[model samples]
Target: MREPHRTDSATATRDTRPVPCRPADARRTVRHAVAERCRDRALTCAGQALDDALLVTSELTTNAILHGGGITGFDVAVDSGGVRVSVSDRSDDVPVATARPDEPDRCAAGGRGWPIVCRLARDVRVACLPCGGKCITAVVPLR
Candidate 1:
């Protein structure tokens, strides 16, 4: 398992690194990174929040692979209240949340990723990078 590169500042501790764009590998890598960082920071990672964070990480990384062309970077930060997960991709298009269709036949083949991420994380944000890419961040509170 690869560990995240840690950087310490006055305000907070951040572990940021780049993860591969492959779906299966990216999901596993992100989960491992989150778990390891949480452990190192003495943060709780053995409850509903951990589960939710892992799920959100998986969904976000998968979305990057499927929709964002590829993942360019990833970061997990330990904040005062919670941990923030940021996944950057080469595509600048932000994600949109759409309600699930009542009829299965009317539903699109895909589009549930952002909703799932929003539901799992306490907060979510998207920032457009200077390189014309975008980074989607989700924060999961420790409980």
Candidate 2:
């Protein structure tokens, strides 16, 4: 398991420094980090929260790769409130949740990541970096 960089301070408990973007393995890396942090915090890893967290992580990372112009940073933090997963990319395009199709189309091959993230996460935020990028953060409650 590759360890992501860390920043320990008095106020913040567990915050990852920032993992470089690797689209192919971004989902796997973020999921692993989330699980490890949950375990470290003594949170149940086999519960629905964990499952939702992993699914949200995958959706966010996939969006970053496909629509955000490649991922530039990734971070996962676990605390009393909940688990927060942040994915940054070069593109400043904000993610919008698209409505589900009225009818099942066999040829439909894309769209749905944002809605899944919104549904799974308790809160979602998008912050524009001063440097010229944006970071999307999603928080999932342990309970």
Candidate 3:
């Protein structure tokens, strides 16, 4: 199992807090827990934003697998302000969001993922860490 990266408290303030979560199925349960926190805090309306959060997590995870080589684990953190989803993968390659002008259909699925993530999330960040790995995080504002 891969270990979570260590960072200072100052950095952690802006990060997803690097929670240990299973890369596969457990991510769903973890996401649900975060969504529930959002709900309990009254940060969002409940259903729609939770769906959006899940979708963003799915895209980030898929990007980790397809472009960042593969992932061993991921994290989801929620506060009163927003929801942060981060997927840690084995490659340092940065993910670029691109849509071909001529072939609009080229992004029908795989490529469209980033676009959706960008639109739904208030902020998006892609980090290529020095240690031959990457973390893509999306911050979706509550309500």
lDDT for residue 39 in candidate 1, whole number 0-100: 62
TM-score of each: 0.74, 0.76, 0.71
Q: What are the Cα lDDT values of the candidates?
A: 0.72, 0.71, 0.65
Question: What would you estimate as the lDDT of candidate 2?
Answer: 0.71
lDDT of 1 by residue, 1-143 (tens): 12332445543456544566565565556566556666666766667876777778888888888888878888766555566777888888888876766547655567777888888788888888887788888888767
The residue-by-residue lDDT of candidate 2 on 6-122, one tens digit each, is 445432245454575554365566556656665666666557887787788888887888888878888777665566788888887788866657447746766877888899899
- Residue 84's lDDT within candidate 1 is 74
Q: Per model, how many backbone clashes are there?
A: 0, 0, 0
Give a tens-digit lDDT track for model 3, residues 32-120: 65656745555553677777877777777777777767775476666655667777788876666765675656545467777889999
Location of the lowest summed lDDT over 10 successive residues in candidate 3: 7-16
Worst 10 residues of 2 by lDDT: 1-10
Off by over 4 Å in 2: 1-24, 38-41, 100-103
Clashing pairs in 1: none
